[model samples]
Target: MERLVNQDASERNAVEGKFGEGKRKYGLDLIRARLQETSETVIALQFLIMNLGRKLRVLFFKFLQNTILSFDN
Candidate 1:
């Protein structure tokens, strides 16, 4: 159906955007490990770092909000 197609396209765009971000900012395009295991490890680490960065940003915003509120009181 048309609805299904739209949903698929939306999902695909989000996935592709993540890949582009990884390649551009995380050196994903530079991976050169020869062995399958090593390549997998490197990719896994890159994704892990990406996840940690997202978490840190969330935490930082929360901290900043609290700091600003404390200053108001």
Candidate 2:
């Protein structure tokens, strides 16, 4: 990564040595990916809920109309 960055960049870029596997670096990436997926799931669930509410409202109105008409008979 450092080598590729230095080639494209006009100024000198500092390169770091090999990083050992540990809880810090790997944990942070995993946390970020999980947060991204959670946000997407929340949005999808919200969309589904909104559609369901609309359908329920339509059904309620239909039932109300049927009740009123039957009472007039």
Whose TM-score is greatest here? 1
Candidate 2, residue 5: the lDDT equals 79
Worst 10 residues of 1 by lDDT: 39-48
What does candidate 2's lDDT look like per residue over 6-49, in tens digits? 68663433112111221233332233334868856664554566
| Number of backbone clashes in candidate 1 | 0
- TM-scores, in order shown? 0.92, 0.52
Summing lDDT over every window of 10 consecutive residues in candidate 2, give the lowest-scoring window: 14-23
Residue 14 of model 1, lDDT score: 98
C-alpha lDDT values of all predictions? 0.98, 0.56
10-50 per-residue lDDT for model 1 (tens digits): 99999999989999999999999999999999999999999
The candidate maximizing lDDT is 1
lDDT of 2 at 8: 61
lDDT of 1 at 12: 100
In model 1, residue pairs whose N, Cα or C atoms come closer than 3 Å (at least 3 residues apart or on different chains), thus clashing, are: none
